[model samples]
Target: MAARSGRRRAIRGWLGKACTVIAAAVLVSSVGAAAAPAAPIHAPVLRAPAGGYEELWVPSSMGPIKIQVQWAARGGGAALYVLDGLRAPNDHSQWTSDTDALRQFANDNVTLVFPVGGRSSFYTDWYRSSSTNRQPITYKWETFLTRELPDFLAGYGVSRTNKAIVGASMGGNAALVLAAHHRDQFRFAGSFSGFVNPTFPMWNQAMRAAMWDEGQFNVDDMWGPAGDPAWSRNDATAQAERLRGLPMYVSSGNGMPGPPDLPYGAVNTVNAMALEAMTMTAAQIFRDRVAALGIGARIEIGNGTHTWPYWRQGLANARPMILDALGAH
Candidate 1:
């Protein structure tokens, strides 16, 4: 009888210890759940474009932005970010709408990232919410592209550590500014007909005029009144010394008629001529600054204007150089 009683007590003691262990595990799990980081923002694929390209809606601090990504065939290496011009459309990147970049890089081993929108905003973080052509504008592009987008991309096996960026016109300036500010992120940068100097006298007014022509935006709201440090901070020419060790390509046309501009009644030819003239001056200044800094860069002065064909040709010329920098072949 005594043996049976002792066995029952021993079983009860074992059960009590097991219960205590279970309670301790539950407490630790609750504490961990409370301390963990917030869940990542979900980015769903919006659609598959014609050339095996997938467009995704990426959540950002500004809002949900649409980005088209063409993954590399082998799915590894640095990514190339292609930015648009001053009159960037809200729907898609001009790299797709105007040029054959998607088709050209379809089989390459480096992912091509094209971010849409940011018309006349220069892809920079603005001072405050403002209006353009009576439409409310809120821009946080620098933060989104440099911070949020990369974090999101890292989830999909894309290496955020290595990147190359190229831009045309306003995007070109933005690319230089981004590379200068975030040197560890981008190793190669290119600019085609970009207005590299915004702080020069009367240059701010010219930019204001261009912005007004594009979207009737108030230039004062972009960076502040003329002579603001923001202008100098974002000027590619001003920051040339910072780009000394990086690989770069700078190209611009001489504001003349090229093969594509010689077409039948090309109305945009005159606009290209004038626009390229303005950008050419700034580009030359940028080239000289880069040279003064002893940076070895490929600078091309072509016999074309600020047309799509000229920019497309610039991209074609820069492709091998960019691939070489990214080790993409």
Candidate 2:
């Protein structure tokens, strides 16, 4: 009987040891599961279709400004900022609407950026809101383009410093003004049928008339008055010396009907001709001023008019120089 009790005690001890071992194993597994690392979360990519453009709402002090962006074909970091004219629409840039800009740069290794909506604002930071039209927001495009937009673009692999700017008509002068002041941002600047010299005689009146006709925006709201220093500050010709080291392309038509102008009706063609003539005069003044300052710019004067086709051709002509300046393939 004593031998039997001893065997039972021995079995009970073995059972206790087995249960402890199993409990320890289960605890280790629970601790291991709790210590495992989790999967990481990633930010959404800011990209477009394979060969198309995407609309990105970039934040700015002026509000959330919408910009149309086409990523580089070969994954380049350089960008080309295409500015719109005085009659710029709020929906999209005229560059995308009127010209074959997308197809032209589809295979190129440079990101294309088109800033939308700044009709008759001259793409400049206005001194005050327009009193005539009671504009809701004070225009602050200069700050948005130079500072806010660049900072936002840096996160998307686009170089803030390596860039080019081009514009037709109103945007043309604004491009030069931006390049002249912010040399660190733009490597190249181009003006196609742009009114580069706003301080020229009778030009301010022309601008005033054009602004009123387009958007009822008073010119006084833009630069304060006709004799304000802001006029000279914004004038590309007045700031010619500032553009000394920058590569520039300036082109204008002689107000004559070119091959591109043949498709339009008589009134439209005549209007384009008149506008081109005036813009050409301003462009020439800017060119002469730059020349006097010993600044070399590719100045092309040919037969065309202030129309999309001519500006499209101008962009095509400036493509090689622009690509070279930006170090794009």
Give the best candidate by TM-score: 2
Candidate 1: tens digits of C-alpha lDDT, residues 1-329: 00011111100000121112100000000000011222333332212332446666788977788777776656665789999876665666767655677767766677788898887788898887655566564688889889988887776666676889999888889998999999989989999878788786777776666566555676778798887898888899899888888889889888777677654134445556656776788888887887887878888886776666677788888898888888886
Q: Using Cα atoms with residue i matched to residue i, what is each candidate's TM-score against the true structure?
A: 0.83, 0.85
Q: How accurate is candidate 1 locally (lDDT)?
A: 0.70
- In candidate 1, residue 67 scores what lDDT? 78
Q: After superposition, how far is residue 280 of candidate 2 from its true place, in Å?
A: 1.2
